[model samples]
Target chain A: MKSRVIEIVNKTGLHTRPGNLFVKEAKQFESEIWVKKGEEQFNAKSLLKLMKVGVSRGDKIEIICEGPDEDKALDSLCELIASLEE
Target chain B: MNLKDYLFEYNTISLQAEANSWQSAVKLGTDLLVEAGTVEPRYYDAIIESTLKLGPYYILAPGMAMPHARPEGGVIRTGYSLVTLKTPVAFGDVDNDPIDILITMAAKDTETQNKSAIVQVVSLLDSEERVQWLKTAKNQEDLKRIFESLTDFE
Candidate 1:
């Protein structure tokens, strides 16, 4: 598995629109991806679960990816999280 | 304020309507908000304008869309309106297009209240079973019961 910890820098954080975009990006990879905040973890493809996690700006999140595309998934998702705006 | 409180106070449920486009579908919900005095006439224009600017970023799922704009768009108070369409309309969203449910929300530039309302609505929309139940429910009382029952899920 490959993983990285990133901060949510977007003003709204991982709420409705950002969460939806995250899930959409996560769905593009075949790797099993999970997002973790504090003690809770959720499947990165599930928008509802991501929203339920209630991550906010400045909150740190850990993304873990496993499978054939783990490294690529980790890299892409890290960039996505870092670049999230609006 | 709570979901039930807002619904009861505003009677903001409109069912089985036809909309020619996504903008009109949103109009169904914004109309209720306008009626409740939660927002001014321009709030509807803001929502449509933003939709044009932002794409259908508000389309939350396959058949549900939460139409809203920032508080500065003439929000008189924090309120919400639920509009269930008789026919689903496409919003050019790839993942969550052909929306049949429009829930318009307004807030007064406050974070906590807006967050609570969004969270509550997201929870309610998360359940496919519940959303389907909502789409098919017979009357306003049914909608009231469904909204009230959200307390149990919490």
Candidate 2:
């Protein structure tokens, strides 16, 4: 498994359009991607699951990817979160 | 934020309803909250504007769509409106299209208390069987029983 820890930089965190974009981007990968916040983890591919976790601004979450393209999945997800603008 | 309590309190559960278009479906859902004083009239407008700009991004699953807008977009209180259409309508979404159930949310903030409402919906919709169960509900009692049946909701 490949994983990376990143902080949500967007002012609104991961909700609304940003949340949709994150899930859509995660679905592009063949790997199983999960976002872990503290003790809780949510499926990165499901928009509702990710939103249910209630990600907010400045929250640090770990993106864990496990599959054939785990490395690519981790990098893309990390970049996606880092690049979100409000 | 009890999903069952919040939905039933405002009498927001609408089952076997009819709407010709996705916008009407959204109006029906948002109006429930509007009448109950959970939100202002502009809340529905906000939802429509966002859907138009974002293209039905609220359509979360195969038959379910949890429509919501930002808290400042005329939300007087944090609540939800549950609407189940008699016939599904297309929301211009290619993947999770033709939404049948819409749980419209109006939250005050990003706190866990508010987000737990979302978790309850996700819990009930986590399985296809549950999705079908909610979609085919005949009445308000059926809807209440369905929410009660979900033991995982907390």
Candidate 3:
């Protein structure tokens, strides 16, 4: 498994539109991606679970990817979160 | 404020409602919010406009959706409207389509109050059995009982 901790750059974090984009990006990878915020960790590919976490701006999250493409998945998801715009 | 409190106070739930299409289904839910004064008429327009730009952003599952516009889209206060359609309508979302339950939410801003609604609603529908039972709510009293019976996200 590969993991990276990063701060949410978008003003709205991963809520709504940004959240949708995050899920869409996660689905493209063959690796299993999970987002961890504090005590809660949710499937990065599922929008409902992601929205349930209600990630906000300035929040720090850990992205974990495990599978054949774990390394690529981790880098891509982290970059996506860091580059997200409100 | 709690979700049940807002629902009871605003009286914004419509069960077994009718809508010919996805847009109308959204209108049905947003109209209830408008009547309750939780959001202005423009809020509905904003939802439609946003949907046009972005696909339905709140299709939680195959049979349910929790639609809401951004807070800047004329939200008067944080509130929610529940509308269950008599006939399910497709929202062009191939993954989660033919939605029958609409939990339309309006937030004045991204405060704890609005976030509470998201957590509460997600908590209320935690199970497939729960979602099926929610579709069985035929009246306000039934919904009240259902809401009271919910134990999660307290």
Task: State the C-alpha lDDT per candidate.
Answer: 0.82, 0.82, 0.84
* Ranking of all predicted structures according to TM-score, beginning with the best and ending with the worst: 1, 3, 2
TM-score between candidate 2 and the true structure = 0.89
Ten residues in sequence with the least summed lDDT for candidate 1 chain B? B109-118
The clash count of every prediction, one per candidate, is 0, 0, 0
lDDT, candidate 1, residue B8? Answer: 69
| Runs off by more than 4 Å, candidate 3 | B112-114
Name the best candidate (by lDDT): 3
Residue lDDT tens for model 3, A1-86: 99989998777777767887888888889998999999999899887787778898888999999999999888888888878777
Off by over 4 Å in 1: B148-151
Candidate 3 lDDT over residue span B8-51, tens digit each: 89898899999999999999989999999899999999999989
Tens-place lDDT per residue, model 1, B1-154, is 7655786689888888889998788888888889999999899899888778767767777888888888899899888888888889999988877888887888787475336767767777888878987898767888777766765565
Worst 10 residues of 2 chain B by lDDT: B109-118
- Model 2: lDDT equals 0.82
lDDT of 2 by residue, B1-154 (tens): 4667888887988888899999999999889999989889999899899888877877777778888887878888888888888889999877778889898888776563235656666666777877788888998878878777877664
Give model 2's docking category: medium
The alpha-carbon lDDT assigned to residue B54 of candidate 2 equals: 72
